[model samples]
Target chain A: MDILGDLLLGVQTAFSFWNLTYCLLGVFLGTAIGVLPGLGPTATVAMLLPVTFGLSPETAIIMLAGIFYGAQYGGSTTAILVNLPGESSSVVTAIDGYQMARQGQAGKALATAAIGSFIAGSIATVLIAFFAPLLSSVALAFGPHEYFALMVLGLAASVVLASGSLLHAVGMILFGLILGLIGTDVQTGAMRFTFGSFELADGISFVVVAMGVFGLGEILSNLENESDRTTVLTKVTGLMPTRADLRAMLAPVGRGTALGSVLGILPGGGAMLSSFASYALEKKVSKNPQQFGKGALAGVAGPEAANNAGAQTSFIPMLTLGIPSNPVMALMIGALIMQGIQPGPSVVQDQPVLFWGLIVSMWIGNLMLLVLNLPLIGIWVKMISIPYGYLFPCIVAFCLIGVFSLANSTFDIWLMGLFGVAGYILRKLDCEPAPLLLGFVLGPMLEEHLRRAMLVSRGDVTSFVTSPISAVLLLVAAALIASVLAPAIRSKREEAFQDED
Target chain B: MQGHRTKDFWAGAIYLVLGLATVILARDLTLGSAARMGPGYFPTVLGGLLAIIGLVSLLRGLLRPGELVERIHMKPMILVIGATLFFAIALDFLGLAVALPAAMFITATASKRFRLAPVPLLGLVAFTIFCVLVFVRGLDVPLPMFGTLFGG
Candidate 1:
């Protein structure tokens, strides 16, 4: 069957009464969580993992996916209103978005983002519906060697895309791969880094590490400078974009959707890099590049669209292959595992309803977001008025509850606190949390693959880079390392990293 | 001005100590063979990375090119960390019945913006009861409801 037919079949499953309701529930909860500063989709998905134990995996996943993408929409709300990004993707949004808000065009900026996101999300869903089957075939063709190479590529690209020193990023990726190796080895069943502690046997929970690293890390960083900065209190005007505003947004939104859909499939830094890349592309392609920072509607629309589109399509690599592109997808993979569903190539054939239903629900959820977010802008803005003190404690409570509920062990709670402190220290030292979280999430997987590859090749060290795919990936990694060492490229790349150019 | 320099120096010294400790502890574990590898393989690598990163940080501090001291947040950090510790210690002893409510209260009050109001306690009580009914009895997850309700 053609991709469209399969997508229509997926829509048939998704449009059912139960699935539609679940979609709505997912989007509502997702937006609510996303609006809260510092709580990204990873934490939200982890918190909700237990609640979905009763539901069918499809229903649970559709709802969870809703939260993931809806966050892309709702996260911008806080970034624009309060000048504090809810997630890293929204950091660039804050640059132009808060500027617009400060100029009393907060409503216009948000409205364009919402509409642009909807358009981009719709188009991206269509692209996913059409492209996923083909991509799944490609993933299916990959051998163990190819899979290992792909992961290395992901790790390297993530390093390239990270915001700081290239050397630091490489170090962080290696750190993550190492941390991932801490549990019982899959092949020999010999414990790697446990040091005889039973708690260390199963390995560190990515949830604990991620929550501590990004969630608590941000809170601690903010508290460090809490007294120095205050949240902006911007008055919103009309929420409607003018016709001229709409005209200016049209091309960028289209281009952003196209770019983001393709970029979103990259494993490590797809959604985030796509957003920054789309913004840069818009600037370079724009007739008037000078209009960028001064509330150009495309500045708001393009990245917003790209962010949502990338967010939707990012599910491809995760669903088709067992590998996750980012921490949120890793969390999603964990959720799928908890539900007894392995998110790999067989998932499509083994669970067609789940596969199609999820694809169909993305469109429904996007539409639902437009419905919920547009009218509720006032309510969300009111939520931005919440004091950081009250808000942060609630977050801490959720983290405690979520972590404890997973294993029903107080040990995990203590581990979470330990991670919280560690995260705070990392933040103080200017280390980016995303790489750490990514490292922690990918650590175990990388180790499993490494040992498995070694065992298969009878301890052959060259096996990892001998394959054509692996060689290409390693070449790319080497080039990235070389460019980092070059002073000229290093300076240009730093400017790109800062997005100041 | 002297206090600022002293602060960076101490911070660098602390990192150096931590890195040295990691290396020393790492030496105790054999990272296994080059071919097969073992459990300690990754941590040893990470420890080395941490040591290198720490050295770079220490060197950066040594140069002292610019002023870098910022006021440390003692209160919220202590409260957040302390409250989490309190919850962990209390959970097994007091059980979820008393421990959960107390933890929730501590978590709620940890925020500097909150005031000691009766309303929050009431909310905590209601929330605990809801969790017990849903997660413990309703879902039948066999949570640690009470330590010795029947017998130890």
Candidate 2:
């Protein structure tokens, strides 16, 4: 009953002329670039964040969120049309989607991904719309201690689930937290790491750091193997799936949506992991497993559903608790912060229109993506065929201009350059920048809560454990860390990443 | 010092140095009691944890065997980063009209596909103008088409 009221509110805002145009633009642009082999939703969002600064926060977010899943839709297109996945989450889809393409089922594969994304996205949007208010109510009860503990759990979970060695992830988090603590201290006004530079007074912008690390850094690393790249577009036909094809995919889509919705809500898990998990699940549960890598329709349907569903529900923790489940959410959190809106439970109460409108816009965006992707599949295939040589320069130009536009400062550009190099080196060392971004975004909040909790309890460190909710959160964090050490889970985590490679 | 995993060894060493530097830099700030933390408290603790993690990673690098670190591609790294730096330095002095093309041109050289042909150069110039028109004329992003160098 209450959801109906919220849905009406969402409809009133989402149907506005400007919102619809921008949302469509976002999905269209997102899909175009998403078809680019190396650029994913994360990079696309980061690249385009500067464009959103000039608009209203609601409209800006609507567009950015459109880009998020729009990229997913486009990525699966590339997965089917070309064997190369435009994004990591679509890797599993490409395995079977490409095989189906070789079998002259490119149209069916693309249609399956499109239709499945719509189903999962529609359902997932409803879930976010309904669940956010409830989670906000629960979060409303959280104190500084509970907040502190939950953040600890979020950070720990990100590191544990992070690819590569657990030690490296922890070290990266520490490094990020330290980097975040740079600039004048808010409470004490003491400069921690500004080194007396006047520009450093405000602290490093997360936009610059993120754009450099994920955007330019990625470009540099990609250029390392630029000479040895190839693309062969399979001719796509028959955009509609037959009745038998649709029937075969029905169960996998349902199962994937369910699995994805759950995993997407977990800290440090999002579309990438969910798609991988759902693919593995489909293989395990299928009657004919051998047909999987050779173009089983379920293999295409399940992961596409899972990926879209995961992308949608991953917004839950971000919208409710302000903790990013992944880099894209971190960018969203950064966008929200840039708009001067603190990202937490209060958003639901203070900005109900924004809260509900974004949820409703996702469903609208998914519908638009489905319509846009099918006819535009040919264009997207052409995009992936463009050599990386030309694309890299354009992306670099965007980065140079994007960072400069943020504060109209050359210093941020220089900082981005430094971080670009740092990012490349970090990647070379087998370290991931995703968890570091998480830590950097969460660092200030973590320290603030830690201090507030301590101040409230008068320095008794045990107070963290004394509070029941806080204690349980800490226990969960401990268990997550312990699980990382269990050797078995560690191997399985490696197994998932290796499968994609 | 000379075991396998040259990459991890260097990564750990860098982390260890960074951790030490952070701790040393923050030594002057007061690390107050737990109940009332000073500005330095979180950084100091994080820095210490970093050092410990670095130590573990370093030991692992020395003891365990893994694949050798991939060789760094200095040419692309330098060209890309250098081109970016050039853009930053030139944007104010040279303006987007000249600086953007220059940056894009330098970046094109990062790949082996770069050349001095008129078409490629013309394309670069056209793209730079398009960017200037969009960001400057259309969006009014405050970048100058012609800067102090041209007496604008």
Who wins the TM-score comparison?
Answer: 2
Give the residue spans of candidate 2 off by over 4 A: A227-235, B1-5, B116-119
lDDT of 1 by residue, A1-501 (tens): 566667777889899898899899888877876677756787677667766777888898998899889888888888788777766677778878888988888888888889999999999888777677677777777666666676776777676667765545554565556566666766567775567889888877777776666566556665544331244554566887789888878998999998888878775556677788888988899898997877677777888899899999888878887677777788888778878887777777778888899998999999999988787777777776555655566566667666777677777778888778876765554455566666666666666566667768877878877877777877887786677678998888777667632
- What is the docking quality class of candidate 2? medium
Per-residue lDDT over A1-501 for candidate 2, one digit per residue giving the tens place of the 0 to 100 score: 377887789888889999999999889987887788777677778878988888888899999988888888888887777777788789899999989888887889889999998999999998998888899889989999999999999988888767677888888888988888998888899988888899888899888888889888898888877653344444567998899988988999999999889888876778888899999999999999999989999999999999899999999999999989998899999999988899999888788778888988898999999988887677776677787877888888988888888888889889999999999989988888888888888888999999999999999999999999999999999999998789998787788777865
- The DockQ assigned to candidate 1 is 0.37
Q: DockQ numbers for every candidate?
A: 0.37, 0.80
Number of the top lDDT candidate? 2
RMSD to the hidden true structure, all candidates: 3.8, 1.6
lDDT of 1: 0.73
